[model samples]
Target: MSVSTDLTPPAVILDKPQMAENIGAVARVMANFGLTDLRLVSPRDGWPQERAWATASGADWVLEGVRVFDSVGEAIADLKTVFATTARPRETRQPVRTPRESSRILYDDTASGLKTGLLFGGERAGLETTDIALCAGIVTIPIDPKHHSLNLAQAVAINAYEWRTLILDAPPPRFRDSDPPASNDLLIGMYEHLEEELENGGFFYPPEKKRSMSQNLRVMLGRAAFSEQEVATMRGAIHALARGRGRVLAKLAAERAKASSSSEPPRGE
Candidate 1:
């Protein structure tokens, strides 16, 4: 019934996990190493289940507070550094490290108050190439190459144990250093403002093409969660262009009015 104090509690992310029992077992493993903060990204089995809680047993706290997200990006939205746990290499070319090495790094960064997370793919197919690429690093447990497959909860337990071994002797946890980017309201406002300006500038015009154009623009901007300062600067640029276009239109309208009046044959003769 002992827990490791050296391991930093990670925000454990499970991507499309299949079984509720496996999820509960993972929670138990996390509890064994003093790790909590479970996050589920599109779990195949609906969460907050009695089956999972029953499996978790003494680790009910972890299972009770498990967070659910729609996507991997949303799951780790607040994390500064994330390590992906996978058995196979994928599209991501990030340096692969063993569980022990990853644990040491996680301990160091967590001690310095950096929000870090670890991602575990699903049971059957594992993580997709795109899912792997979303993480900053990859952690693979060293096992026999002849038969290297591991159960979902087993993988979680192994990593959690390694993390605990690394940080057990460190000092108390420190304050987190950085904060997440702007809130959703701020980002949505920026998107709307930019969309309006683009419409005014004839960038997203032709009426028929507006839908696709706006969607593409949203997708591009949405990917790079801009900082507060970046959002402010972008908003300023859009406003400047909009104001400039407004002035030019006003000037053109005045010129047209004056020309039409002057050419009216001296007030209808």
Candidate 2:
């Protein structure tokens, strides 16, 4: 099957959220994963809470476009399929799906023009039993039984990441905007320069082992796969070191000449 490019994102419905910070965090996570539609069903404080904006951390777009409704039914009235997220299971007969499974279903449904929504409960208590009954399915996060409680934003992030995978088949590989590798000519030149320096510095001890030592050095330098700029920088470093050695030798030679003259007898004598 072909990948769907223009799939509609599901609406994020928060049912009776308790704190403004939690709402802000939820919006931030939703923005991170590309879910834009945010709906609130009777937030404890009120809609347009000033604290939410501060906690959102620049995810103003989600907060700006958020919709407020008096009840869950009204909030999700336009949606065709809805899934409720909860850590615990209910006694109802609705099918329970993990975040991953639910995301896959949401992807396919949205691709086929179905308006979908994900319902989340407040921070203190999760989705109400009555609210869970209204959804088409229940989305349960698989957390450790010893510490099953999850933050409101953390729960949203888990589901959002799964939703992101549907758009991108998998996480992309590491990318860098690096220049292309240095050409063979530049690499060869760099290797020769370093080898010449090492030779002058008496780095390769034992004349019999010079060839092997030189080959090992070449291999090590080649492993870096330097760029053009890197090659130039390395050559500059080698030249500077060579100049420093030359200056030291010249100074010693000048000092020896002065010592020899001081010990010579005067011409008049």
Candidate 3:
């Protein structure tokens, strides 16, 4: 049977994932819990591999719809609420909740028409401090301190199972028809505009430094899928800033040209 959209789907994001087998295991877990959406952040091994498919078993559809991204921000762009799954605590002091508690909140939020997501880190190392900072909350599975770290797939499975258990007993939440978030074209255009403005502002000058500057900006913007309103708001701010600088530069140039002309004698005289 095909995956049903009647229940609210939890978007599962894998950040810097290590192997295809783990990805497949994640797919299987998601399928077991009736969650379908999967987002990948910078997978070390590319998707749709034989190992992943073999591990996925009956959940090939999840693999088919899995979206691959280059960064965590890109993976959760469209989601309004996001939970980062991590065992280790970070310096930022964000709200940390157990998997069951996080699942209940997610169930409630999604029932109220919020788009939600869960983020999982790589196998060896969990989510970086910066990545955890991006989430609204952190979901940690309770475990013995000596063996706190769980496998990547196991972590996802635990969260999914909790969420599923919450949702299965209740009447499925009404499927809200959310407007398509910012289209790829809009996002690409915004990126181009920002890069150009940064170049004009001398933020990314010196050809040697341009690569890092561009990359940093890309990572900052790629995290969430922006809405149309969000894109417009960002574009407006960029334009306002750029216009202010443009006007200042134009005045300076005009003043320089006028001074040069006044310094010259009349050509016909």
Give the number of the best model, judged by TM-score. 3
For each candidate, C-alpha RMSD in Å?
6.4, 24.9, 5.7
Candidate 1, 128-217: lDDT as tens digits? 665565566689999999988789999999998887776555544445444544544465678779877887677876789876666556
lDDT of 2 by residue, 1-269 (tens): 33345877889999899999999999999999999999999999988999998989999999999999998767876676678898765555567899999988787667656678899998887777656655666899999999987899999999999998878873322243555455445666676788788889998899788766665565456556566799999999999999999999999999999999999998894
Cα lDDT of model 3 by residue, 178-202, tens digit:
5434644566668779989988888
RMSD of 3: 5.7
Each model's C-alpha lDDT?
0.77, 0.81, 0.79
List the candidates' TM-scores in order.
0.65, 0.61, 0.68
Clashes of 3: 6
Candidate 3 residue pairs in clash (backbone atoms < 3 Å): 73-223, 74-222, 74-223, 77-224, 77-225, 78-225
Q: Which candidate model has the greater lDDT, 1 or 2?
A: 2
Worst 10 residues of 3 by lDDT: 176-185
Displacement of the residue 219 alpha carbon in candidate 2, Å: 69
